[model samples]
Target: MWRDPGAPADSFYEIRPECTDVPKSRFRIKAGKTLSARKWHAAFSPEGYLDIGKTLSRIHRGGIHPSIRGEVWEFLLGCYDPKSTFEERDEIRQRRRTQYAEWKEECRQLFPLVGSGRFITAPVVTEDGQPIQDPLVLLENNPDGGAIVPPQTPQDNNGMGPPSTDAANKLEKMTDKGVIQWMLTLHQIGLDVIRTDRTLVFYEKKENLSKLWDILAVYARIDTDVGYCQGMSDLCSPMIILLNDEADAFWCFERLMRRLRGNFRCTDSSVGVEAQLSNLASITQVIDPKLHQHLEHLGGGDYLFAFRMLMVLFRREFSFCDSLYLWEMMWALEYDPDMFWLYEDAEETSDKSEEAKARLKSIRHYGKYERENMKNASKSSEEPPLPISVFLVASVLKEKSATLLQQARGLDDVVKILNDVNGNLDAKKACVAALKLHKKYLKKAKKP
Candidate 1:
């Protein structure tokens, strides 16, 4: 039940790399050069052959310029690989658009309302692949232009003379029970969509709202298991606002969902927020046993309160713009320069330098070890190049530990305290704190 406070405030948070001694106010991109679209394109070019690690490091040290936020975000979100040529990415983009359109068409076929009144009757096919006639077309061709009368219901048999045209009209308005039950999520999705980013003028338009609904509805149909969740609208609103093309925005959101799908799974057998909450608790117990004991005493040892923050990656905790900044920085730090080439075929061993060969051998060994020990590992996936959102939750709790221990006597106090931090968090400080705690946890975990 987290609530977003309209638009983000004008304040900016300055984040610096873990080792940087530069003052927060003075933080800028690497070497003080701005990361414009031209510079980004050059760095990602095949001819330039710039190291992606170096480029991302520059972006991490100095944020991308405002003019190129949209373009740069696609790279960070894994929509395109650094090694892919512009032409290659364009082809991929077109393919993705086609795929998204097919999903939308599927939605329209299953739920006729999604057609936005563009089509009166949805096309259907019989089991043998025969096309069904359009009912609306038949109505349009009728000379009388009269309503299609429906058969009398049992209630109409009450010795009340032959049913009137009004009764037939009401009866003819059929309810697609199957479709209604299948799409029961429409109501919840609509509610959340309207509430999402309410402060933005873009969301006020009916067409924009419908576009959001269409994307969510189609996605729900595509991934029936996960379907539509409450917080998904919050995650998607930013993408809709930033990306112009609906297809492109849907693809970007899809990629993001791949990384975050674990958070939304609510089934008993699924490793979802409960698993992450356990990790957060373990981290807390080790780092600050006193606070952990206090929380335990207050019946919050489960750490359920951190659910919303981790579920949406702090979208409700920070302002909209700050959330974007935090996500970009997190993605940059998590970017693995070798990820692209890891699964691809390598050249002949003789052609590689000894140093290069050794690096490749090490990477292969690490991958093998990771795959073998993944079950026992605390992280659900391979260890990220940087810490994930769980650490940020730990950081926030640690930052407010003093206040909680001093004044919080029960669970309600803790909830109130966290609610107050909704839109007032400093992203840079939270990140720095999280990084420090991450190092500490790593050192502790390595102890025999």
Candidate 2:
């Protein structure tokens, strides 16, 4: 967590007047009887794109235009469906249904692998070397099951073979251990299955969202206790669509699920989400005190914008392709594919474990540096976090903060600031600024 800068309450930071000036002829103005005007008009029109379709493709093959950035971004991000033909749509639907069926079957088959057969008890070591309790035994075990010996008569209870207290303690201990192993097994297998599952990525069609929803619903049913949450689908949907290999995507999502399961624990309270939000708020306060103050004043500074990012791992804010790019970058930068599950200190005899641990520490250290660098870069650019929309919100204010401070008189001023940014800000620049702001906050948070 980071400390907030003690900025004066009455006065706020000001933007230089030079920063507020809109340049003359910022965008070329159309004039009657002008060739440039005619060219600009034609190029900017939606229908004009049809006329120079091949030419547009050729130019885009080299690079892309800023004018068509939004559509182009959507397309690149796999959120756009260029194949509008009837046959193509039907094919996508057919493939999607098949994928769902295949997923269901896979889950059914995988169930046995996760079940705890006749043994009914799995050994687990606690830090203190005491056997922990299991919840399943307490849940499913019944005195009527006939597995337990009959209780002694009142006369025999006066001198039973074993004391009732000892018997109860042993039962409780067994129950705890059973539940722990059950949970651990569920965690491990669930992660493995989700990580490997994959499906077609063409589910971005509005109608396909419901089908995608169904797939996630099935996962929730499989584990009703955890059920589903906002971010799980966001993470799973992309993998299903992009990989086109259900098993592969399932396992990948599974691996992610293992690490992230804590985020979705349905114990009635959202403690995990709150803690993350608090951390984000603290970081923001430390790095960009002015922006933090503005948000706090505006009633938007508790880091609510980060909720989706933290939950979905940045799926909603970025296009699917860009999200993948960012995710892969994050995974590569932060997690080691080869050294996963290697503990910091373990009594393993394998030589590879030693090698893995060294690599693990190096990667962990490197990830910290990379995260800090990324945060700094985003702040310098006055951007927000790529994974969270708040950075973009903060950037708009930062860029226009001076103007806003001068123009805004109170809460209405903040509202006006938000109003102006609604759909008017460039997503790319906003993303850049978000990254800059994150780094800036992180750096400030490190100060004594």
| Candidate number of the best lDDT | 1
Best by TM-score: 1
Q: Which tens-of-lDDT digit does each residue in 330-351 have in candidate 2?
A: 3323322222333212432253
Root-mean-square deviation of each candidate, in angstroms? 12.7, 19.9
lDDT of 1 at 131: 30
In candidate 2, how many clashes are counted? Answer: 53
- The sequence of per-residue lDDT tens digits that candidate 1 reaches over residues 298-396 is 999999999899888888877666677677766665554344344223652234355653442332223211222332367434654323688889989
Task: Give the backbone clash total of model 1.
Answer: 2
User: What TM-score would every model get versus the actual structure?
Assistant: 0.70, 0.43
| TM-score: model 1 vs. ground truth | 0.70
